[model samples]
Target: MASTVADVAKMIDHSLLRPELTNEDVRAGCDLAARYAVASVCVKPCDVALAATRLDGTGVSTGTVIGFPHGSSSARIKAAEARTAVSDGARELDMVLNIGRLRGGDDEAVLDDIRAVVEAAPGTVVKVIFENAYLSDAEKIRACRLSEQAGVAYVKTSTGFAPGGATLADIRLMRANVSERVKVKAAGGVRTLDVLLEMSAAGAARFGATATAAILDDLSGRLARTGVATVRGDLSTDRRMGPDR
Candidate 1:
């Protein structure tokens, strides 16, 4: 058993990256993040300023995505986006790596693409999204190596727009591949408290979730009932998570 509700709350980055979300929707998401005191609200690039202004002094960091669902943008373009986002007050930047390039084994291109954004934003927390659904295990390992080499803060599972999302197997693999300094962030399909716990046990330290309210609400209820909400999965074992035990 591990973690209080606050611990779980701090692990989540409330997602507001959907294309259909309006400015008002982003504002509401910011409010929700502030109320929950989550780690950050990852909004669309255009919403960075709005989210920053709304979340000011609330201790919830403002974040945005780059090259987004598709990692098709040029390295220079992605770097420009990163700089603009930082100027708009975004403290965190999540960038998608070039999936096609990675698949084609263009290691240098992939590494340079990630490095461009990291260089553009000097002090921000940059998370590299692998969009693992399309990668083989070997590819995943390579991606992790590249991310660590590029000096990223976190290596994420998916963009949530991909065909598949975070899985326990991928989380474990990513954690095993990266060094202690490089954290793993699970995103996409993390809709329940049990799922998050499973991922955490598998070695994910950060989570990107749109189902923030329900997951936290469920934990709050459990804590209220039992006076504690603890994760049962053991980090030491990193065992295969099955049916939540």
Candidate 2:
């Protein structure tokens, strides 16, 4: 089925995780996310409370990262971070997997690391970031399997601090390997509506985008040209225009 503007908007996790971002930047990002009705505003750990406050009644969930750009933190520390973030009104948590441990073939340690956070956050949605830029294909698949076994909500592609970002091949591989219960999130490099749609077709159910405004603006323009209503299943223009038109 063709995805409408709302469909695309709901897939975005508006990223507010840049280290240099100030409180003002986070607030502006939250406003933008609310204005566009994005799925969530992914901010830094410290900004979760403020984001939640600003996003109250906005229907946009708040999210933050754990073990952030580097996944070298001990499992205990990551678990603590998750617990704190969840208590502060963060409904979603994006945590980086331990790349070094995984590379060292310590799958049990890696699984334990992920499980610790999941245990801490109980019902909170958790997206485990693979930071695929540093992992081999085999390692990536192993990470996905471990994440599924750990019962995480999603397996994400990149942290956007890596040398490379989410790629089509990686998305396809992750999608094919994981079970249906596990979703795929493509972060980094999802800067435009075209790329977002392409990733969606490749099996990315969610995207972490710093360019949420620009991409949604482009989608709005396209929908306007096609005269398609933003509401799902309206189908008023389904016959008048093709899905991509």
Candidate 3:
């Protein structure tokens, strides 16, 4: 099924995953998230507490990363991080799947790691990042299985730190492997309306991006040109949209 802009807007989980992000950056990210009505604002574990304080009662969730861009952290450490972030008011956990262990053929170790974290999160939604850019086709399918068996809510494609992130092919493949109970979150390079629509068409239910403003700007422009009443769809052909909204 094709998705409308409204549907895509409601699905976005805007991301601020940089290691050097300051308090001000986190604030700006949260503010934009509120205005855009994005699903959540994803940040590092360290910023979860402050973000929660700033976004209080806005209906935007505070999300934290576990194991982060690199998934070499031990299972015990990842589990602790999940517990701490949840206690700090984060409603979502975007934990990195341990690529090393999974690729090394220790499936049990990898599944155990994800299961342990899932056990710690009772009300929190956990989306395990598969870092799709680094995985082979077989590894990708296997990792999706582990995510399902561990009872997570979503399978994420990237950390945005990898060489490449969230391709249409990858999103489709991940969606095919997981059941309807699970969904796919595409990150790393979701920067425009067309790019977003591409992934949404391929079955992505969530998007992680740093360029939400630009995309929304384009959408607004389209709406303005066609006159909101007549432009429910196909607003691009209208000239009234102006060069800038």
Whole-model alpha-carbon lDDT for candidate 2: 0.91
lDDT of 1 by residue, 1-245 (tens): 56667879999999998889999999999999999999999999999999999999999999999999899999999999999999999999999999999999999999999999999999999999999999999999999999999999999999999899999999999999999999999999999888887788889999999999988887777666665455343522122322232
lDDT of 3 by residue, 1-245 (tens): 33345555678888887878899999989999888877888988889998898889888889989999888898899999999999999999999989988888889998998988899888789999999777899999999999999999999999999999999899989999999999999998888766776677688888898898887767666665555623233222233444322
Counted clashes in each candidate structure = 0, 0, 2
Tell me which residue pairs clash in candidate 2.
none
- lDDT for model 1 comes to 0.91
TM-score of 1: 0.94
- lDDT (tens digit, per residue) of candidate 2 on 1-245: 66677778899999998889999999999999999999999999999999999999999999999999989999999999999999899999999999999999999999999999999999999999999999999999999999999999999999999999999999999999999999999998988776777788788999999999988887777678768656234222233333442
Name the best candidate (by lDDT): 1
Pick by lDDT: 2 or 3, better one:
2
Where does candidate 3 have its weakest 10-residue lDDT segment? 229-238
Any idea what lDDT model 3 has? 0.84
- Tell me the deviation in Å of residue 213 in model 2: 0.9
TM-score of each: 0.94, 0.93, 0.90
Q: Tell me the deviation in Å of residue 53 in model 2.
A: 0.4
Error of 2 at 235 (Å): 15
Off by over 4 Å in 1: 229-245
Cα lDDT listed for each candidate: 0.91, 0.91, 0.84
